[model samples]
Target: MGNNEYMQNAVTGWMVPHGEHSDIVMSTRIRLARNLRGFRFPIAFSDEQAEEIGKLVSDALLNGGKTGYAYTRMSDLKALGRQTLVEKHLISPQLADAVHYGAVLLSEDETVSIMVNEEDHLRIQCIYPGLQLENAYRKADETDNLLESRLPYAFDEEFGYLTSCPSNTGTGMRASVMVHLPALTMTKQINRIIPAVSRLGMVVRGSYGEGSEAPGNVYQVSNQLTLGKSEKEILAELANIVSRIIVHERKSRELLLGRSRLSLENRVFRALGTLSYARLLPSAEAARCLSDVRLGIDLGLIEDVDMNILNELMVFMQSGFLQNFEGGELTAEELDSSRAKLIRERLRQRAADGEPHPDEP
Candidate 1:
């Protein structure tokens, strides 16, 4: 790409924002989704002829892209008569109610986009507020938005903020694609092509990115270091990556389709809730869960739970219970100091039932 691309990306700072948070919060948010683009092959196959498109996407993502999610068209548990190929571990009990939104089974030549929510993300909205705020806000998303206001950088001592230069602050752009590049990473031709590839605006990192390592042997080329690059520069990089990704995607379209790609959307949330309540978890536990949360999103298994915020929030919410960490809460350990005693009380009759459950402490 040329400097014109970078120059075009340079724009004035005039973003209108939503939900007010300190700069620390604005800068600590993680990029949750990919700005998707797709390619269509010359030929299409009938639904009945498809056996493995979903697996194809899954393998490709697991091998090449940072994020991997699939759509399953297999029979549904509640359908008139069908059975899906997804494992029970891939399904979450909490989101069992929202399962419909969790998975999709697309036909041949179909495309899907991924989205994750940043709880209090601000978008520069135009034409909606008073003239002062009009057109000042960035678009609803990063690809089309502006970084109107940047907050100061801060860290969470308890949960530990994600540390890396050019951090993916507010509305960080998370671009993941389905690439069929098992050999591309090792090929000599590709080695020569990388410099040209990256100059267009991408970083060749592992599946997870800088914060975490790739789960398996997969390689990911995401865009995380663009603080100084202009919008056009970033877009050019994204477009270039999209172009290369299309080639790989097409190669795998035949072997992988009509299958599911995510594994832990609900479980991740449940884990979050569990971690939040399990005050016993130390800093390492919190850090591990943070990566787990990231895995859930990258694999298309989970939805919008900000790990950094969730981890810190867990400590804040449970600070009151740390005193009980010594042994037990006054309500239980103080009264009986024995598991048998607690269980026995729970099963006792009203007459034998004893002290109030709420005030036993």
Candidate 2:
């Protein structure tokens, strides 16, 4: 499918709920940063040099018997297009800002994407639905091997892989899982949990990763250091930590259901009612409501609505995706209205198709 066509589609493999803990865990991602030998890092590279590196990396991956990969230059995409990609997590905010010679090579299913001329010469990434870190790592490692076979990498006898950032030097691998922790957040346990996790070489950031706010009670938990650990060790450590966090979240959820069942159910149904019938919905408010509704589904407070729709709405409600659906730039006010319309239409359709309304007995 073409880039525009792919962007418009609601379903991607990673967005679907599957694997272990799909209820709370959104997805797992593995990213490997590698720089080409004898080339300057992206920070100091000229436009010509960036172009050269982009071509070299793209050629190696697309021509090295790897089928189903599409190459798109960052400069060729409009702001909306790039923002759409960022919202979908197919590319990073940094890559979206790369309006020069930067490019991305995306697999057909979008499970794998290689960003060329980002912070490094290549940022190889693979993502999977719901707590599948091992699967993501395996795919990323396979792509790394495919590229390393065809392109020379900057490596060191001591550091393993050379990257622009010192923190990413050794394994050059960042393993992360996106999780919904509404129960913990509501119970005020997230504050304690984040610091405790950080003490264990893990960092928790908002859904879109670093430097972003966590809307919808969604957060990305990732390793903080890659300098001294092997890739296996890093992945194992992160998996263990995330599993524990999941257990904590589940416990908090049970506590909430036990002690404050009426209050929790009231909050969830109110959020669902707002989403189902509101005439105007801001992006942030929409995200918050969606989180509550998702919590309701997981706790069995509500049934019939598919979790996949909530996942899709999380991306679709973003400003860029909403504007893309409308085919124009929108003022903040317009976006709010459009977002509400989209939500109401979607939820109303589900209701029309035999799903009971939130207000129904």
Report clashes for each candidate as comma-separated counts: 23, 0
Misplaced by over 4 Å in model 1 are: 1-180, 185-196, 211-217, 228-233, 248-361
Q: Roughly what TM-score does model 1 have, to 2 decimal places?
A: 0.25
Best by TM-score: 2
RMSD of candidates 1 onward, in order: 25.4, 2.8
lDDT value, residue 101 of candidate 1: 27
Query: lDDT by residue for model 1 over 1-361, one digit each (tens)?
Result: 4422321222111111122221101111113221111211102322321223333333333344323334433234342111111111112122223223223322121112211111111111121111111122232333122122122213233422222223543233444321223223323344654476577556655432344433222334556653455434554555466556545533432222223222234545655444434424443344345444434443444444333332122222222222222233444333223322222222221112243333232
Question: lDDT for each of the candidates?
Answer: 0.30, 0.90
Candidate 2: residue 166 lDDT (0-100): 94
- Local lDDT at 261 for model 1: 26
Across 1-361, the per-residue lDDT of candidate 2 in tens digits comes to 6533543474678888898999999999999999999889999988888988888888898789999999999889999989989999999999998888779999999999999988898999999999998889999999999899999899999888999999999999999999999999998999999999999999999999899999999999999999989999999999999999999999999999999999999999999989988878988899999999999999999886767778888998999988878889999899999899888766755552476555522
